[model samples]
Target chain A: MSQKPEKLIDKKGLRLDGRKPEELRSIKIEVGILPNADGSAYIQQGKNKILAGVYGPREMHPKHLARPDRTVLRCRYHMAPFSVQERKSPAPSRRDIELSKVIRESLQPAIFLEYYPRTGIDIFVEILQADGGTRCASITAASLALADAGIPMRDLVVACAAGKVDDTIVLDLMDTEDKKGGADVPVALMPNLNAITLLQMDGILTFEEFEKAVNLALKGCRKIYTMQKEALKAKYESVKEVEE
Target chain B: MPTFFERRQLVTPGDLLAEGTYVTGENTYKENNKIYASRLGLVEYEDKKINVVALRAFYIPKLGDTVIGTIVEVGFSGWTLDISSPYLAILRASEVLSRPFRPQENDLAKVLDVGDLVIAKIMAYDRAHDPRLTVGEPGLGKITRGQVVKMTPTKIPRVIGRKGSMVSMIKQETGCHIILGQNGVILITGKSLKDEQLAMTALRKIECESHTSGLTDRISQMLKKEKAKQKEEIKNESKT
Candidate 1:
């Protein structure tokens, strides 16, 4: 384990990665990468690599769990053993279960589950590499996969993290900033609907700082939302070109 | 009086298709007099109605649709068939048997065992129950021979083309009998394996280029070229 650096912010007031306090890390997204999956997407945000696959609006296994009047969404969030610096166990850890539940809840609001009664949509998100904001990236990728699968969604969900590092709040905390930062707030938003789907905070933040962090995270979400739309359309660019 | 996008324009979830009492259709939802796309698809306008033609999607069963399916389970009085949909379709024993159905005397598996393929019609479908299927039609029964090729359900229209041009062309060119299932399953049978494969390749080309314009003509040209190539190879083999 590396020792925590004494200064997370440089003299120019930039974060350790030379990003402005309100700037986000680079993000790359691709859709329909897995043939077997009904829908799939891969996301690379900074050093974090995540893959999400969507299967269904199909029959639910263990039939009793299916609801009579609405479709059930099942989510699984898992990290590969080598995702972190140390080898994490492949089994579903407590944190993974909690994240899976929260991510599912975050995504539920966007889908029109009532269209497919008694069926199930399974979203599987695997963190092949982790930096700090795996959950947020996973949500972003998983939502794209759902859209790619042609599921009815009111809007696409996008997420980002903001936190206080070296007494200065920053947009999109990296691993070093998250580990040593005073506070971290992860927020997911449906940009079109202007609704916050998920919000989580850890460590300490003053009320004013919390508000700033959330607004900053929402700003980041909105920025990523445009990229999300582009990625979705890029998957269909061939179709569009041929139409023209 | 205003629409946000052009007809057949690519749209993703949350894109505004139109506003002010535009009746929403499939893959679109209305919110406060505004119609928005509910998935990734192309905008389609018919009169005052707005629908999004999804590019990739699951097969939702509808009444009177012909489908190819594999029998997954032989139940007591019916067979559960997978029609490539979220729900399993039920092919009742009574629908298949001409005589008065006596369950005790009948051997259901002997007729349509599990794993056997069939060309069936969706007799009924509703949200309340699984789709009911029937194989009583003359051309819609057990698929004895040939291969089943699957493509995206949304691409099936391209296989048939407009007014049955693409499919009929392939049928005439390859001498292959092709049955297209609404659920994206296709069954091809021909005099020889080579002919069947030609049909499959032509279908695959259609699936890949379904979005392109003038696909019917292009596919016809491709098939003609391949057929000529195959004949030349055969003639050379005879000489050798």
Candidate 2:
């Protein structure tokens, strides 16, 4: 690994990745990638690679846990052994468990679980690679997967991260900036509803800086929301092409 | 009042369809006097109402619709059927047995055992209970032998086409009996295995490319081509 740069923001007022303060990383998202799962999606943002799959609104196993009023939403966030510089254990670690819960909560707001009572919908997210903001990306992909599964949702959820570096706020913090920067904030949003479903902060920032980071992150989220819709439409457009 | 998208336009969840007095129909929600799509589908305008035709969805059993399912459990009073839905369907012994059912004297599994496929009609369905199915109706009973093809339930209407034109064309071309189930289960049966295989292929094609135009013509051509290929194979075998 290269030595940490002394300044995350260079003299040109750009991030280490040569992006402007409010610029997001390159992101590519594909929906319904896994045919076996009811719905699935893959997302790549910068160096991060994540796959999310959704199953059900089907009958719940251990029927006692099934809710009478609405479908139960479950999620699992796992990291691959080769996803990082150090091999991560395949077992669910404390961070993975916590992230799974956060991701599920972040996604729950979008899905209309009441449509299917006495049922459960399961979302599994596998982090093939991790840079930073895996939780945000996972939330983005999981909601898209839920939509692809034909699950009713009030809105699609998208996420992005911003952080403070050298007294300057920047959008879409990468792994190095997150580890070395002053503060990191990840945010997930339902763009149309103007609702923030997930918000997390690490390190420290002043009140004004924090506010600026959140606003920047939200702007990044809104940008990604458009791509999320396009990915869903592209899935069917490709199928239409296959017909011709 | 400006509608964001045209009728039949593809839309994703949270897209504003219209911002006016348009009535919100199925798969849509009204908020702040705006109707937004709640699912990824094609927008539709039905008189004063706006609805979305979902491209893919699970089978939610509706009353009087025919469905095919596999028996998963044989209870004392009823049989549990897996109809590829969030809820399992229930078939009472009274619905199947012509005579009065006596639990001790009669065996339920003997009639419709687990894993047995059956074509039935949805007798009753509500949010409170599992769908109740009855199999005593004419042409609805145990599926003895045939090929089964599964598809997205939302695409079933496409498989049927406009007023049953596509299905009837398939039946005529492949010369097979096709039973279209609302639960996305299809049963194909014919005199020969080749004929059944041809019908299954045609149905699968229809399900995959259901959104495209000229689908009926495509399915007709597909079935006819397969039929011609099967005839040629049979002729070559006789010569050999």
Candidate 3:
């Protein structure tokens, strides 16, 4: 693949973010962070701030399209007006709707929806700040929100993006790398089972390079899973002490 | 079993798990083979799944929650209230259980005009539909005088505490009759504006610092200090 000029200054093979090609960004996750929703979470990966709120498993589905066997996962991904350099419209545009659909699909396999047959789980993800890898961050945030809402899940979905930049594969691409680099690939993985729940790629890269990028993203997912586990544990411990 | 915090535990973002073994309908769960509990509430649990709910110290209105709102807008058959929710609540003409008084065409606003806050309850919710509200009680009309402050709805439960403990403490200290709106709006009617402002300030401080340990004791001490300071100022003024 023909790569763009290098934006990351590699010192001893380490990128500008002080991370090696195989290292992921620093991630933070919290569960039950929102007041109004059944479950909610806030996640921050470097400069990214994503808040995901989960409502439902409620019986109030659309009257016309009610299903009896499975719960519908309605996902909405929206960027706050102040999330990016340019202000986005408050209303969900076509791009937002498409992104929502993709996210909903990606999460469907992880949730045990049949447990709440005839109900629906609505996951709303709002990006307070967007640096890069928003889609993957949303996936991770939504999973936590769902779990916070106490929805059953086969496994937590961990997501992170990787790409080829400056003729080298990088894990967990930063905002600058995503814009100026080549062959960006975002992947969501069931880290416990090592299964890919979602995958997307843009830009140009050969099959061999793509495989390397995928491997890097999967490794990032595992790292993220550990962070997610710690967040939930801390929240619980704090509350338990209060009760005791 | 999760390890106990021998000292104060400072919780950060990356400390909790996204999913774990939760006993359904319980507010606590097990993550990494360790059991964890919720600080605020157990919202719901079902089938080995549990959800922890957070309590807000300030009041914010939710659909169908009963709240004391103020009539800020008077329309044809209803009045608009300044509930702390995102949407303003409306008390319809029919929902007003008053004596047989036919409201005149132009008298709608006259009966309940702007600048008047009321105490009404949210009767119905139209998530995509309009909110239907009601003021069917004696004290549900326009609020003539009071000061208002906003806080998160989730925080209201904490501020109220278990069976109104926190609110009663504030009321006894300030000698102010406080009306808490479900939508994070608080109305404080004191002997004067200064007193009202002081009460409001105290409430806001409490909301912001609710999660801190020894909150109730701290607030009580703060209130006592403020009272003593005010008493000293009055004494000095009298001597002068």
Candidate 4:
């Protein structure tokens, strides 16, 4: 909102990643990447690489933690010790736990819990690189992993972040923009019906500005949803062709 | 302009949605929706409420999953195997029914040495704790002097085929007792090293080309050709 930072040199209000205020980063996704996981995916959006592995919908839920009506969604979001610029601590710190909780809540709505009553679905999302918007990346990767697992889902959950930088709202904030941006708003959307499933914003923004940011983020989410659909369709089609 | 929820939704990496759309109450929301730019994705409106679907896969270890494992540590009760899953597997002492008459010091490593390649079954997986495994049964144990090949655990079911037809075909052709680990570690051993090498090559082909149909027939023809070649070489040697 004030003077632009040196890194955010805005000739026509575009970020260093060559994206406009409402443009998102390029995303590449591959499903069933992890052999051990029931469903898994590797996703790369710009420099952010994330691997999500899904396990369960299994019977046991730990007697004390069992739910009566639907299945439980347990998620763990972790960064590999070598994922960051510098090596992170080996053990999960408090920050990781909190992030995991948020991710779990975001993914729970997409899962069909009633289908597998009294069981639990465990999703482990690992950040292989931390450029920016790790949470959004994790959500996208987790959704693809779920689809690969053949679990019944209404639609895919696509996530992306939008923030204000240099007096303009930019979609898909890169690492530098995230740190220096005025306000950061990350969103996960069910792109098909145009619904909000997960939303988090930090820093300062007026109500109008916040709504605009959400709108821009949604636009980015739609772009990502197309890519997700294409990737899954391509994978299955390729296999099916081979079978034929 | 179309509203956010009305647009043909597209999902991008790292998009977040509103609070109530995906979760319930103050902080929770639904998972997957059909709505564009909505955090929960698209939705099919019914009965004034939306139904959300999961967009990720779920890992479930079944009764006879063939897994690739490494002997991480040896314990008095059993040997620990790191199968790259949430839970590690234990090959218990009792499961190893054929123990030496008088167990000498360091006998565990002798039979199943540290860092030995093993293809075992998921005898039982306890959600409360680690999974219990058994390599002592026929066709399961510490795999020494055999080549190990890796594949996706999901593809194991396809590779084995219906009612073990695929595996049986491979075995009859190669004359090897192949142990399929639920975790995708395949162990194949033949009477001689040459036979073992041939089997390993064939199995690797299967792993890579599993998506293709009629694999059984293709592999059967390949093996028959190999067998005839071997017979011709043997005949030439006898004439010499």
Candidate 5:
């Protein structure tokens, strides 16, 4: 195995992965994959693989934590031990807990929690493989799982990450680029409402670059939103044809 | 200036449904004279009202609906039942058995202990507390025999068919007594093991092919074939 060259982007305006600066990695989504959970979904983004399961809008356990006015939303973001090249721990790490909280908050806006008052909705996202931007992919998968579970929501949330690498703004950075020390910005949005639900930035960027990255991420999110809808439609349409 | 999506059109959250002078229904919200779908589902237009019927979802409790629950805990006066909903169900001792209960002499747990399945009706419900259940009514109470099957709550309507025509057909052909819970629990009682297994298969077929048309005819054909096979087996056994 050879080390990656210092130059992250070629003079031809392409990245090492042969993608343009503004191009995103390929994404694949499937819904209703788990039989046990009320709703479940799987997503593949480039080399990242994630599975999301949703349970409840049913009872809330540890009864003390139950909210009286609206349904409590609990999210768990976990990485399988085999997800990384080096085996990861099965237990929840500090990073995992923080990610879970952010992910849960990102989704709370889209769901109509009040509709299922006093109940709880639990979302579990497992990272089977991690390339880069697993958080964004997990958020996307969790939202789809929630939809599959038939939870009422104001909108579906879509997410994408953008980064500044080699002095150029790129959409959907890969694991290699992410490790090269750059400004990575992950954004989650309610695409139809054009509202940003989650945003996190690491490294540094100029004001102009930040604005451009956000716009690029939003555009990428819209594309993801379209794909999500298509996946759902394909599932339902096939069922319809069989019925017909 | 009312707008509408075509009947049976699939829509996702934030997709516009109708605008102006239209009442929004389930899984829909209105903003600035425009109604939008609040979830992924099929659009419905009826009686000048637009609604989105969700394709899948968890079951929420409703008053007067029948349910199949397992006693999870026995309290002083009531039992906590798991009805497969997010909200637990509470069955008071008074409503559990028809006979008068003397707390000093009769223990509620002895009558209906944990892990026992009971068929009950939702007698009362409120959002803040667990739904109240009653098993004293006829055809309700502990499930002494039969197998339990679960399906999607949304598909229960299909299982029942129009006014229970489909369920009755399954019972007549398989000779199985089936009780369908609105929350998607099903109890099937058959006279023989073979008949019970056949009834379960027929129920599963409905669960799988529920979206298709002519299901009633298809189920009837499947059941008729099974009956013929059973008759042939009986004849061979008698000959021996």
Candidate 6:
């Protein structure tokens, strides 16, 4: 890895990715990509590419793991060995495990798990490329896949990250900015309900900057909410086109 | 007193269908005086009630419905069957044979071995236990000499059409014995391989284009074209 320049933002207020201070990376989302899986999605956020597959509300194995009252949610977050600049090991790392747990918890609030008692829904997310904000992008793709699988839910989950770079608070940091940045905060929300599902912060930030960063991240999440809804609605609209 | 969206309006989960004095039906839940869609489906407003019809979903077994199942495991007294649902269906030896008792004397596997296909009826089911199946009913027993086609449960209704009209058309045209299962399994037996192949193509076409309009007309046209093409090929073969 190489060190970034001392100044992440220029006097013109543009970051290395040629983005404004509050600009997010380009996001692309597609649903129902994997025919075999009950539901699947592919997402691209700038240079980061992620694929998510969902199966279940089906039978749970090792019978004892089944929840008597509600459906159990299982999530696996993995980064491909060649995803990063350096070749990483294929084994699940501590960070991967932690991210998986957090992503599952973040999506739990949106699902109506009580509808499928004694069953389990499995979510698998693999990052084929990494820039930054992979966790947020993973959550976005997973939620779409869940909806694609026809699982009942209260709302879709949207996520975004904001960080302070070079003493300037910025939205949606890239890899270089994240490595050299200060106080990276990732936020997940249920946009329809205006509720936050996951909020985690690392590094240093002052009280005012923290508040600003959270507000910026929430705004980014709302923007993502629109994209997610469009992706889902597009699937049905295509059928309507044929009807006419 | 109730307001409803036009039929076939697409809705995603959690989307608000309406907010008023109205009765809610399947795939729609009411919360705080507002009705919300619970599935990715089409909205239907019926006689003062609102509901969303799911586009695709897993099959939920219901009592007294005949189903096609494959035996996966055999116990001392019953056989474990996979009905393509989340729960495993149980078929007892008594249900397999009309005669009573003597589980200790006869081997259950002999009657229906693992991997054998059977057409059975769901006798009972609830949240606590697996559904019980029975094969003693007429036309319900081991399924042999037919090709089975699996499809999405939601598309099953479209394939069957209203009052079995769609399916009967296919059977009449192709001369295949068609058994429709609510759980997305169809058994088709024809007089010859050509007849079976014709029916298969028609059914697959229906499944793929289940959401479109005027599908019955399209299917009938397709069947006619297929028959004509087959006759042309046969004439060419004779000339050669």
- TM-score for each model: 0.96, 0.95, 0.62, 0.60, 0.92, 0.94
DockQ of 1: 0.68
Deviation from native of the Cα of residue B25 in model 5, angstroms: 2.1
lDDT of 1 by residue, A15-101 (tens): 777899999889999999999999999999999999999999999899999998999999999999999999999999999999999
Model 5 TM-score is 0.92
Count backbone overlaps in model 1.
0
Backbone clashes, each candidate: 0, 0, 32, 84, 3, 0
Instruction: Indicate the DockQ of the complex predicted as candidate 2.
Output: 0.79
- Docking quality of model 1: it rates as medium
Q: What would the per-residue lDDT of candidate 2 be over residues A60-106, giving only the tens digit for each residue?
A: 99899999899999999999999988999999999999999999998
User: What is candidate 2's CA lDDT for residue A39?
Assistant: 96
Candidate 1 residue B58 Cα shift, in angstroms, is: 0.8
The reply for model 1, stretches above 4 Å from the true place, is: A238-244
lDDT of 3 by residue, A88-107 (tens): 89799897898898788888
TM-score, A chain, model 1: 0.97
DockQ of 6: 0.56
Put down candidate 1 lDDT per residue, B108-152, tens digits, no spaces.
999999999999999999998999998888899998999789987
Collision pairs in model 2: none
Judged by whole-model lDDT over C-alpha atoms, candidate 2 comes out at 0.91
Please provide, for model 6 over A191-229, each residue's C-alpha lDDT reduced to its tens digit, 9 standing for 90 to 100.
766789999998899999999999999999999888888
TM-score of chain A, model number 6: 0.97
Cα lDDT, model 1, residue A92: 98
Tens-place lDDT per residue, model 2, B57-109, is 89999999999999999998999999999999999999999999999999998
Which sequence of candidate numbers ranks them by TM-score, best first?
A: 1, 2, 6, 5, 3, 4
Clashing pairs in 1: none
Task: Show model 5 residue runs off by greater than 4 Å.
Answer: A1-4, A241-244, B1-4, B232-240
Which numbered prediction scores highest in DockQ against the true structure? 2
Cα deviation of A110, candidate 5, in Å: 0.9
Candidate 4 chain B — worst ten consecutive residues by lDDT sum? B34-43
TM-score, first chain, each model:
0.97, 0.96, 0.92, 0.92, 0.97, 0.97
